[model samples]
Target: MKNLMFFFATALLTITLTFAISPPASADVPPPPVNQVLGLFDATIDFTGADIDREFCQQCHVGSQVERHHALVTPTFGCFECHTLTDGTFAEFRECTFCHQTSPHHTTAEAQARHCSACHGSLVADYDDGHYIPSYATSSFTPLTGGVEPDPTNHPGEYAGGCKACHMEDIGQGIASNATTHHGIGITECSWCHDVEAEATLSIRKCEDCHDVNSLHNIQADSDNDGVITPGTETGGYGHIGANADCYGCHVQSFLAFMSTTAAEPTIPSITSLSATVLTAGQAANLTIAGESFMNTSGGETFTPVVEITKGDNVVILYPLPAFTSKELITPVPATLEPGNYELRVKKDAVVSNKMTLTVAADVQVSAANLTEETIVITGSNFGNQPGETTLGNTLGTVQSWSDQKVVVLMPEAVEGQTVTLVTAAGAVDNTEITAAKATAAVKEKIKGRANKGSIKTKSTK
Candidate 1:
């Protein structure tokens, strides 16, 4: 009885000591349970004997003091609630301090202040308050429970209340009930099962031990440290501090997608870059890709870039899916381009990137005919710069012509009437024949039609 009284006195003193030193910040540690400070143990250097206040214990604990031959009358919370022996011959246990004495936690708030700073660096001034305590109790130390009690606004359920309310399994049935175990609410440690094999049986771990997570499956940050990615942040059961861990944290598959995939050595053609990130329509954008393989990936999968082009409000199928020019041109495909802003998406061994954009414009192409005044005028392609160019082709006979984007030329003298042919830098030739112009007026009409085609006009100095 005397020892019991002294222990309660110490329990009360522990509360005082905890409050007397310094209380941690609201953000530092979670609040201990309200009843965690329940009555002092009927102290013993070893706790295996009888509970002193047997009568008082019966009041609200809701269980039995003496368990009979084959059954316990109720659930357990305190020690005696589990029953020592049939005849009251109890097995003693050391006080909680004997074993739990080694404090493996933040000894002081100052030491803990750093770990929280990584994300909360913006709230330096609010870190103003702190308190230290040998144990949590009222004394020379002030309370750092944030307020008089656990702050309701700070989400008590997340910290303490959740422990009790979530243990619904404890109230099993009649007197044969079991103290509620935290079934699956994740209030228990996660590393306990985060990496568990699909066939591993679930281990019932203690609730307070949940935060000790390790391994990638138990991880929470950037796998590649690249800043942004898929299935972000949370890596643990809930999207918690453990979730935002490194890339390997929750997604080993995604990490392996990059780390394990082998990029093929020069198999096709190589590009230097991935091209632009954004573009305008018909802008004639050039893609900047480099490497030897027409296609390659972190993995040895064959792949290519599929390009589609569009211009201000006018999107067109300028390029289609990855189509190889030939087996030698496998994977990476270079587009025979037109004019417009383009979007490129790559699929290298099934790993595709978001669409990248670029610009393209073919403004040099334009039309014209010969004037009766002995001057030959030609159009088609972008010409204006060298207007003094000599007219090499004639409208009178079968005229053959080649054009730079700037201008077209009529070869000197052929026949009185002839059809026309055109050639481009890409080696494309067009001979959509037009009527021969025998008279000046007729030649002028042909010039007007070709001009409408907007082919740039030019004359040769020769």
Candidate 2:
């Protein structure tokens, strides 16, 4: 009984000393129930562990922070995936290099600035002056946030923003729940949004997301390096810069002038042969010229096919038939040509075809007319070396022989004073005062005298 009483007295003394050394509690209030205190602490901590839903994080991360996390994080990942928990609290991670070693963001500011051109080349090329960071004269300028208006001077080229200035701003503060931040609207990085096949295509529409119509036209970059600045169609290094608008829209007449100067000149037509190399003067003939690339009338409103014959400094223009083809064209020879050689050419637009030789012979002329017992001899220049029609008065005559300069024909029964006409392939000649009866009598007298002389000579020989 004495030992038990002493143990109780020591326990009582220890309890009294512990209470005396402890700090005083406020207002002597008793501690809350254990369950109530645990419940309050649980509300501040994420006890769901790895299976926790994203809604648990949304409660704390309200506006742009939530939007930025959703945009950059992969779908399969959650808030805890990139962050760490220490003493029941979550710590924020600012450096992407902590988890991603090869990430594009793992570089210095200068390196990041230089690498911007790889993806944003069109934006870099448009402005002649280099990109610059915006400067505010006073510290009173508040960054854009919930329900705040953007400054008018904050345009792209004015006192405007650079890449980080615009992209890093708090864009989701005033935006609707369904809306997205500026960086979330379109893909800034190729690898993040596009697959291999999509990257290979590199369509121009991707560039139109940030660059407006006028901005693309101002680029003036020879992207393909073909020496021609075909904005919308150019490909390769910079992708497609002009997807929303063409270069001509802003350049106007200057674009047209450039195209005119750089375009290929029209091909000149060639003249190989002509139908009638030699034509008679004072007569019209259908002439056919054969060559390549002869312009037809159906080419369009600007098609004007002109056929011309040039002699020395003189040029005679001829109209080509509408039915002409590229291979050949039929035109009429002008009767104004004198007896000389000329060059025939076809001109289409500013191109003149090769020259072909064309000769014009003098008109046929009658030299003489004579008559024999049964035939009439007609002599002329340019008889064409062929049989021709002959007539005395109203009687038709048959041609006995023909030559280029002379023709003989059997004369039918006709009066003494009659007109004789000779018609060759080239032209016709007429003699108004030639008489066949007088020439026939003269021929009969000459033949009789020759026969008498022949008879006298035979008698002397016997």
Candidate maximizing TM-score: 2
What TM value does model 2 have? 0.27
Put down candidate 1 lDDT per residue, 1-462, tens digits, no spaces: 111100000111000110011111211111122111111111112123244233422222212211211111122332333224333243442232223343322234532442322211111111223311123333322211122213558754432112222111211121110122222121243343333553433322221122112111211112222322123322222111222222222222222323332233211121223323222222323333322223322234434433333333443332333233211111222233343334433323322222233333233332434333233334555322322223123222222333453233444442223334333321122232222334477555545554334333332220
Candidate 2, after superposition: displacement of residue 349 in Å? 2.7
State residue 212's C-alpha deviation in candidate 2, in Å.
44
Badly placed stretches (over 4 Å) of model 1 are 1-287, 290-337, 349-351, 366-378, 382-462
lDDT of 2 by residue, 217-314 (tens): 23322333343334344432221122222222222222332232223222334454565555667776666665444542211222435676776667
Query: What are the RMSDs of all candidates, in order?
Result: 35.9, 47.2
